[model samples]
Target: MARFEVPDGSTVQAYRFALDPTPVQARALASHAGAARFAHNHMLTLVKAVMDQRAAERSYGIAEEELTPALGWSLPALRKVWNQRKTFCAPWWPENSKEAYNTGLDSLARGLDAWSRSRHGLRSGKAVGFGRFKTARARRSVRFTTGTIRVEPDRHHVTLPRVGTIRTHESTRKLARRIEAGTARILSATVNQDSSGRWYCSFQTLVTAKTRPAHAPRSSQRIVGVDVGVRADGLLVVATPDGCEVARVPAPRSLSAAQRRLRMLQRRAARQHGPYDPVAQTKRRPSKRWRATQARIGKTHAHAAAVRRDVLHKATTSLAQQHQVVVVETLNVAGMRAKGGVRKRGLNRALADAAVAEVRRLLEYKSRWYGSELVAADRFYPSSKTCSGCGRRKPNLTLADRVFECDGCGVRIDRDLNAAINLARLGEPADAGEQGPAGSGPVAGRGATRETDPAKAGDAAGDEASTPHHHQVDQTGTASPQGEAA
Candidate 1:
């Protein structure tokens, strides 16, 4: 799949606000989301059917061209077919805006394209799995690319297609001011309900952001390295090449703070009547009390997530705006969180809460916005084990050793700070106006590769169970680059 290129001098950004809709509007919104979900499942079923039919025909000695005509997997193709079939399959299609259905078709098209490219080795990332049927418990959402989508001048309400003006829980002045100034244009709007049954509207807009003028920062050292970890005091450490510790952001520990409440609520739900009966081995309708408990659980989780997001966004924005060149080490976050199962939960949970990868992801884009540069250290580079003092490598250093003691100079310092210094030393500062990076260290582009999933990362080599489904040969007995043939 080709990446969506933003226009010059403009960036794509999203503005999301919580919504407060009337009961009628809320139901209508849910109904529209349900329609989108239905379309996704409907089209996916047809696609699978066509693939299976072609494979069966091939096994019966039918020629390639003689097999059933292949269906186009593009958005226009799927939407066209859905439009034709809706009158019969969905007699109540007129209740929702067309954009509701378009939402699902667009998602389906992108998913199919990604899977095809991944199987053909044209995509670089984790192997894309075949799309699965979306159930009622799936995320409720619908995107509106067309129709009436706007923010009211009152700055407390926004309008969407089919769903009339809905009040926002917060002021929309942040986005409305930009809209009025012509600095931002809403390209699309999405209405989604989180697990807590709270509705939110996210406006994806193209923004003409102002870049800071290129100038030397106040700090003499231009490059700063950041080290991310699960440590409580120093979730991430930012230091200069000259060993000046500039910043140390403490871990928000949102989840840890709310863990007690979550545990109690989850236990209460377990004892109540849930959506399943273990003895019957089948699904069942959940009781009202169970639903209420689940809602509480979702709200707690959402609050924790919001707190974590706030902390991360602020930290990244500060780094991007103030630093000239920011260096960060590339880490396999997926590998780090894998194989936790019942054991090793604390480490994995803490790592996830820290969200070490997000700091890098946010800096990658924010750096550009601020006319700054982001440099990523090599994946295999051992920044933690190397002492900043005298550049001595401590191969025997372990996690328990919070302080790095160098034998060469008898220097003792915080391990995280030492790692940060090492990373900062990976490269000198790059010109803000320069088009290329200044790193002599092995430099890789964003999205150059994806980390393998935890389970697959540790899987034994040549293990069939760990292989992707698309790797299997098609019925034609020739290599099928795309999984549809298989």
Candidate 2:
């Protein structure tokens, strides 16, 4: 179970439990998921047909205002359309709760809205591609908003709208107690089956939890910076403003350890006959051996994911709870992956295994929950290149450099620890930077301090960092003169 604070004087939390369903219950669950997919596909087809008609009319030189209006993609409109055509599209629609169909229609509505917004430049990020039809073989999930959802008094069973009394693998006493005490209300429940053929349900509840004091005690106030990396010695390093080491945690590298077994399972599954026919868009029933092998692969992957998540959650929760202000570097994960080389595959795997983005995400939310502040240093802050003791920036620091030896101050330190200390100093007073040997301060403005010539920064920093360039810390942590260097 995980809890998140909501702004409405309550906490939005999810309690998930593994389900042990009978064969008949499994079939029913599958049917409901299938119905949801069917409804989505049906609405999409109708929408597409209407769009094609409008496009064709424009080709015939019809005025924009004279053309037929396109069909609506809103939930209510989609539901109305689905209701009119349900008789022909799915005669068994009544077999499942109305919420199942509503779930699919709502998903389509949101997708269409996002697509429209992206096309019109109203939405950020990569333009969303058009929504595609859902396939049965893919991951299956369905959410029920208006359902009779409750945890049984026995703390070992839960009841859903259409599915009655499903036993859980673990005790639900935590949620049961909250519900019994009238401190929480289940808003919605989602039932999903993973590739491992395991069923689980997640209840999103509104909980009113006792709020703790926002700030740490004045005497115990501590601000730390965390540097996350896959190093030979440790996975993470926490440092204080004065460049002192506070804590370190080793990387679990769960996926790396489980790779051999996963490869074997995948290979065995590939050898067995399965129902899927990509070229023909059809699937026959998979053989029992094939199913077994695939399930093993899925379980292996799931275990790795679980282990990775557990590590990240624990690390972030501890940081948020303990630190008053946490600072971290803004990493360019995508750019790191894009620069391909002999070690590209290995690097990508390590980056994925590190799960740095997930760590940041967890920290962001958990910090809010624990009343801590999280600061992201400029993406090109050059924390690694700048010496924590001297504030000298090294312009040409190579990847091979594992230890930072300050040219100005003559102080030697581990590269990661140096970076971590630099980050920790970011939240300190502005004069903190000038106290070092080079008499430098944190960048006066936001983003990475750039060089006058764009080519000097290269693609990784150049694409993101804007100019008028500031003569600041370089790649090697060596501070340059204020003016342009000849």
Candidate 3:
């Protein structure tokens, strides 16, 4: 039987492909994107004006009931207002499809809703400010939901509403085959230009994809732990619970390798007439040389990004397919990169080259696709400091120590290998057979077990589970007597 089977349910996925458009088509696409931006900015301006008017009225001692009514930011309301005023505001509205204008209004509506929810403390993350106007030269993109979008039978051309048929840089056989099989339907298409100046189209499709059994085959049910770091030679290390190495993939360092050429291109571009001249306090059009140099620089950066993404995808897919349970650390990449110094800058570059966060993201979705379970160890689990063989904890291990030596049992091992083994042990089930001898301590929940101090276990049990507290382990490998009460 085939490993995968299509179920009754459907899933939404995007198929993105590069486009090769003529100059005229590129201009038309840019116009549509610009129209969307104009509509968004116009609505935002009106909303802000109404808000200011209401505030001024209230300050002038106007009665609360007599204040100007607040402007609506809903999509339907915005569209209605735009329809009544678009003829006067945008005299060239007839030149573009209605989908272009709708795209802008929809974007504004969502942004307004997000801002309102954030101010009321209903949204997560940092407080969102009011939506800003979109600049023309930043990035251009537009979505078409009501348009006719389809892939040609030859899989070489795609037909989009208004844009007509355009050639694809690569074959769209995968999406074409699915559409022909009647298992997929394109719902929306978004056309966008990347920083590299390359145009692309993305189709959001409702697809019926086959899924396999969630469990790995019994004979291949091996668990592997992944330790992602920038070592002197490699980028990642995969090891099993027995401290056996599975794989070590080297980092390509694409960005670093392309930096010299990019620097030269940027220098040449800077010497030419650009869009703005700060010293002259005047705007100047970019010369042909400048534009060409800029494009070269953009392409170089894009190539580097593609290389990094390719490596990450291959590594994650292989690990997810081969292992039943994949374990990794929950890293705070932003925090690590924030400590700034000359040496820290180099470390930050290395971290960016490794792309640990992207690896984790790909691993998450790929694991689901390949029928593997992904486990994330706690951020403060101390996997590196704890010895995998003896389960002993070291309180003062330094970054300079590449080898982990256990004082309790005199067992020494490579630092990354030890950490990987410790992480792999976390994926083991609690009811699984014993891990080595009886004095080996707990394996599955070893990290959590260190938080339960026998001296204060009774008091801690009475505390609310939601209350926050720090988990500290002492030299004796037991939780500390003192706990922070919340």
Candidate 4:
């Protein structure tokens, strides 16, 4: 992977604000985004055509040198070709800034690279497909790397190339103050329209990050384990090594709460003339009423997402600043939400509403920002099934088992609290000195299955870095044999 090693104590950050543009400014912004879409579709068509022609010639017994010339997929090569054909392809391109065209080409270039790498097994995670042409319904966005991108002095407006100065929905005083102090430098600006037709401007900046403050003393040597769950009353359970529950953040359930309103808006839109013609197998212009209904639906979804994100951000920031060592479990959220039978759909929905995976992501970065240590327990550590008091593993545990009961020590506790306690122990100094999950103790039955976690392998995992918790046991009838992360 390519990396940019910045100077010490400097990091890239973004300040995003909502835009409140007049009708004329809005139209101009939309026009620039439309130009970007046009350039992308036109270039993609050409790229595909050239490849097809070469393949056809090969089948006709043409020599290698006689085949069609290869067309480069890189941004610079695309731009060269674009300039040669723009006279005829887009005569009205002068109305929009050149960065608009560059934005589309850059997007296509990156997509093509990712797709090629994925086809050759050079990339990880999900495989990328070929780039798709941007249609009218596609997302509208453009980036400006140069040309008069600045936050105005009043902190109420921003200046962009071709768009002039546009009023902002919120104050930009925070970013403007940083710029005035020379602590932050604007790198680039991106303008995008959301599904609700609201425009937002995000300023990416290179900022000097302040080190951990010496004035405010942090809770040093303290480890707090965070367990994320989908339950309404216990979205997050934070516990210490001594079985003390620090905080229990109740699930906001924003998406679940707005389901009724979303359903109503969707039904209203379905009754109107929409963009799709099912019988003709083509797209048509949607009615104004349908568009209005869609905007409302989009607004509802956006609101839900904002609420969930806000809650998560607050919870994570508070935890990172208070604790010296924060331990969270390694969860395969993608696999959890994978296509499952009808019985698993509700579980998946609840997990998504709670944004269980986002907890680890937030803590991972915020820990660094606050000069705290972040640790991820191994995926197969069995935090929930293992008895925090007696160190007994219950392989018969199921997802329906909300309360953890240990047969060895006869101890009972809340399932999430038990998991959090186990996680907290993983970050302890004594645990780090130990050899493995079982330490230097005697062996039991067959050991459990072990696989290196690709995501958390680089994290400071302490002693339980993908370590086996309990001896291998048959989990044939168990709903969640590995752990309670789901």
Which stretches of model 1 miss by more than 4 angstroms? 1-5, 212-221, 429-483
lDDT of 1 by residue, 1-486 (tens): 122445667766677889999999999999999999999999999989989999899999999878887767767778878988999999999999999898788778767877887878978978998888899989998988788999999999999988899999999998899999999988778789987889988887767764664572435557898999897899989998788999999999999999999999999999999999999989999999999999999999889888888899888888888877788889998987777687888988898888888888777667766776787777877788876767667789988899999887888999999889878776453434333343233222222111211221111111011111122223242213364757
Q: Could you tally the backbone clashes for each prediction?
A: 0, 10, 0, 0
Model 3 lDDT tens row, 1-486: 112222345544567889999899999899999999999999889877777777788789998578666666667777888999999999999999999998898888777766766676767876878889998776788888786789999999998888899999999998899999998887678888877899888876666653443553322537887888786455778888777888888888988898899889988887898888989989888898888888899899889988887887778878877777788887889888878888678789888877888766666655655556777777777788888877778879997899889898899898888888887777664215223332234342333221111111111111011111121112122111111000
Which candidate has the top score in lDDT? 1
Q: What's the lDDT for residue 276 in model 2?
A: 82
Deviation in Å, model 2, residue 372 alpha carbon: 1.8
TM-score of 2: 0.83
Badly placed stretches (over 4 Å) of model 3 are 1-8, 212-221, 341-343, 430-486
Query: What would the per-residue lDDT of candidate 4 be over residues 278-304, giving only the tens digit for each residue?
Result: 889898999999988998998998899
At residue 335, candidate 1 shows an lDDT of 87
Report the Cα lDDT for residue 238, model 2: 90
- Residue 374 lDDT, candidate 4, scale 0-100: 76
Which ranges of candidate 4 are over 4 A from the true structure?
1-4, 212-217, 277-282, 429-486
Q: By the lDDT metric, which is better: model 3 or model 4? A: 4
lDDT of candidate 2 vs native? 0.71
Q: What is the descending TM-score order?
A: 1, 4, 2, 3
